[model samples]
Target: MDTPPRVPGLGTFLDKNTGTPKPPTPQLVTVASRLLLLAAVVQVVASVIAVVYAASPARLDAIQLQIDAMTGSTPSLAMMRNLGILTVVISGIATITAYVLFALFLAKGRSWARVAAGVLALLTVMQLLGITLPEGLTTVAQIVLGAVAVGLCYLPGPNHFFATVKAARS
Candidate 1:
């Protein structure tokens, strides 16, 4: 039996039937992936801060007032606290999960991941724009990191990598 050809730097074997080699991850993709990971870390830290704030008695009282105003009935304190914690935790997990997944796929030269990362970065910018100024430094860092990651994804090296993969598959 013949040994399959290995793709250098990718640690992946060429396709058995078509013999197309997997493209090595471009430097741009590597940098973008690291940026995405950094963004995720920032999000996690923000989430922790949010959770701590939500756990505070003053914030809980504010949430209770809003709930009472909306429903005309006061929810139990425990229920309100649980809801706040759940919301922060779930949203944080989702945001981090998305960033990590995008980074992983983009590093693999997946074309769809590049599109997804672009759309996410655009949406994040739009959301930031809608918010008032004087946002936390963490928010600013997130925007900058996200922008850099999206920019790297569109750089020539990553673009060429995606094109090579698409051509090979075709």
Candidate 2:
């Protein structure tokens, strides 16, 4: 039996059970990937700033004084400083990893990408909650960015993309 040639104006409806047309990349997924990348970059910058803040003599002195006032006995300022530095390094690496994975998901259309992004966003929210800012600007920014990151994954475009991918896969 011979198959008729597809018409030029007609759209290609791929067989649900076979590999066919290239899957479309949704705008929301693209936005999500970019957001993750931006987050990673910001995290790196913030981490560097954190390390500088932790190592500054003035900051250390302030911390030491606070500790003395609280406990009435001096704690090792060096230990506190080292711990702060360690936190900065660890957080930066985590941010970078999340960014890389999210970007990969966008490029390769992986289903697990959103899961990783969600986890990272959750961690970021938790971290923001624990920090005390001198003003409300940082808190506001954190809330907005975190919301956008999570929101992107749930947007209609990405949701459709995932659905199509799932249907095609099965």
Candidate 3:
């Protein structure tokens, strides 16, 4: 029988005789891609929701009243509403970038993608601790949800989920 191809840097990861670096198994890539796609979908939905709220004056006033009551802030409702909307927009951009990079990493095996994912995971934890923990009950629920998001990304489905993509690429 004929021999398989060889990958230059992989040594014998896939029989040394095989000439192409074995592409990341399709199943793993698909899992990672889907995670990223799901994140993108959630972010887009949230952005749409924010846009709806931003456009509705009555909705904005109601939200502002609640916030003002809670924080004892005397600022006008319009200012508070603008701040909230701006936060949503900024978060949307960051979310889109994260999902896009994650999908790209799964497909192309970029090292930076691995680093970025790890950093994002850590940020998720920090945000939970820094912003959520102090707020109690509702914040606790948000922290749990954030933890799940980070946890899912590192699970076994995403081939070498926590490993160095550069090494795999090589």
* Residue-level error in angstroms, candidate 2, position 159: 1.1
Give per-residue CA lDDT, model 1, range 1-170, as digits (tens).
Answer: 99877666343322332687778888878999899889899889878987987899888888778777785556787888988899999988998898999888778777777778777777666655545344355567777887888888777778888888777765
TM agreement with the true structure for every prediction: 0.79, 0.67, 0.51
Q: Candidate 3, overall lDDT?
A: 0.56
Our tally of clashes for model 3 stands at 7
Instruction: List pairs with backbone clashes in candidate 1.
Output: none
Tell me model 1's lDDT, rounded to 2 decimals.
Answer: 0.78
- Over the stretch 1-170, how does candidate 2's per-residue lDDT look in tens digits? 99889775332223344555547777777777777677666666666767787799987998788777875566688887888788878967877776676766644455566766776667666665557664323434544554686577777777778777666655
How good is model 3 by TM-score?
A: 0.51
**Residue-pair clashes per candidate, as listed?**
0, 0, 7
Off by over 4 Å in 1: 1-18, 67-71, 126-135
lDDT of 3 by residue, 1-170 (tens): 99877657554222333454545544555555555556566557656666666758777879767876875547777777778788879987887678676666545544345456556545544544544232333334333433444444456654363343435434
Judging by lDDT against the true structure, name the best candidate. 1
lDDT per prediction? 0.78, 0.67, 0.56
